[model samples]
Target chain A: MTTEKINNISVTTLANVYFDGKCISYGITYADGSKKSVGVILPASLTFSTGAPEIMECVGGACDYKLPGSDNWVRSEAGEKFSIPGNAKFDIRVAQGFAAYHYICHFG
Target chain B: MTTEKINNISVTTLANVYFDGKCISYGITYADGSKKSVGVILPASLTFSTGAPEIMECVGGACDYKLPGSDNWVRSEAGEKFSIPGNAKFDIRVAQGFAAYHYICHFG
Candidate 1:
């Protein structure tokens, strides 16, 4: 897709809410038909398992994430990106001062 | 609505894309049955008319807005909120150094 199409893609209403609303995100389809996501995570520690390899980008606020097999959680601020392997689960936490942690998850 | 419900509310798929894709947003519903919105605005100036009074909150990045009948544009930084009356139109402009503006619009 061109640059213009990516900025104005439609926001898909379909979503999944997990852990009693702790982990929430919405579905989005690019012009070429690949599906992705963008959502906000509240200040809480949660674990998520993804079926596909994902590129998780931190676009807003602050978050700490531990990829699978890692013992220590690393800080992620706005504008940072991380790659998580497919079929793997990771842990996320948000500390004080951030209203909500916003992110974009890219899937193939 | 309770605090937990608000953060994890599902991101709705249904949306309206206007201005040849200049303004894009998603639909959200509070637990109290009121409709709201959350989306990103690209770096461009656009005009919008609202059908209901909207509380425009700046969650990410910066923007300048001019309410109905106003000649000056006021700057809105992150964590700032503005109220736009129903049936009024406003102008929004985003300038340098910000990627995309993220916002939450509340309607009663």
Candidate 2:
């Protein structure tokens, strides 16, 4: 099942807007000091480079993601997840007319 | 001083996208059951109708807003706040080249 909500966290009041609003996210800090982000990607093909390894868990909608060194685009739907290594670059695309891709990013 | 973060809360994983992505927000629930939202408004002019009386507190960037029945647009910068009445409509605008307007929306 998809994780609908995250509990007992502190949220940064400001949003992190990237690619001129094509992607938006909020940083969240859990009670144990672990960090994550809840974000959405609008209809666009975008490349992202990671600082730390991340597990992207889909909560709503969907996207096709291509991991580093992969030629195939894998679909990640609600309740699905994909992992990306630190210092790696990957591509994600949400097609036009579809809903925005909503996800929770777990960082290492 | 600006309120940089909110503590002891839960966050909705999905986002509320408005005006075709010009405005985006994530819902937040406090430990005591109060609710708020962290959001950003990109460079655009938009109108919003309120269900509950709202306090829009700026945490970063800025916007010019016109309340219902007002002819003048007031500037709300970081650390500033403005209130809107329930059942009323208001207008907010961010300049084309300026940074996105980041805020915490508190509801009554």
Candidate 3:
């Protein structure tokens, strides 16, 4: 995960309005209108829908995931990244039992 | 954790220059003189010396730690923050077995 902080950029948090306690993410915006989010996903299987093209970067633990139209689940580990197109959905499962998946979601 | 990004700041990465593969942290500098870092610590018992005051915020997992002169270990969970004085050495241990410790380090 990238840890560089720019001088002019501010960090904003996102409210957890959906999925209650299972998932949480915060939103960040760049000066040029680019946006990013960092959040944690607890152990569970979930399907997520995205409205914008998103690049998800695993920052802490590994997660097993199956993208839209795929039946095979692939594992994504820390320091790795994957992309999902806008209007698409993804199936993600965190099977590490006690390990919560930490990630950064970048909007394109 | 705050996830909002400002428009003017740039993200930079830090080279892992020490401790081999046990611990890793990335340095992020604000537009001002302030700096921050986000990293993950694998399971281990380590003692570290710091040159500046640091506010360590837990982001993903829990850690068992004994600061400076204390003999007792305390548990710090995700979303909690702890502070260490400059030039102080503290002992940190991660016993979660598989859960890596993720954190944000703020300099003062």
Best by lDDT: 2
Candidate 2 local lDDT, A34-108, one digit each (tens): 999999999999999999999999999999999999999999999999999999999999999999999999998
For candidate 3, list the clashing residue pairs, or say none.
Answer: A6-B9, A7-B31, A9-B6, A10-B6, A12-B4, A28-B4, A28-B5, A29-B5, A30-B7, A31-B7
Highest TM-score: which candidate? Answer: 2
- Stretches of candidate 2 off by over 4 Å are none
Q: Interface Cα RMSD per model, in Å?
A: 12.3, 0.6, 8.4
Residue A21: error of model 2 in Å? 0.9
- In order, the Cα lDDT scores of the candidates are 0.67, 0.96, 0.66
Writing each residue's lDDT as its tens digit, candidate 1 over A1-108 gives 111122324454323445544445666655565767876666689898979899877766668999999999998877788889999999999875555666778874
Backbone clashes, candidate 3: 10
* Best model per DockQ: 2
Candidate 3 residues lying further than 4 Å off, grouped into runs, are: A1-108, B1-8
> What TM-score does the A-chain of candidate 3 achieve?
0.86
Estimate the TM-score of every prediction. Answer: 0.51, 0.99, 0.51
True contacts kept of 2: 0.99
Cα lDDT tens digits, model 2, B1-108, are 998999999999999999999999999998888999999999999999999999999999999999999999999999999999999999999999999999999999
Q: Predicted chain A of model 2: TM-score relative to the true chain A? A: 0.99
Ranking by lDDT: 2, 1, 3
Give candidate 2's TM-score: 0.99
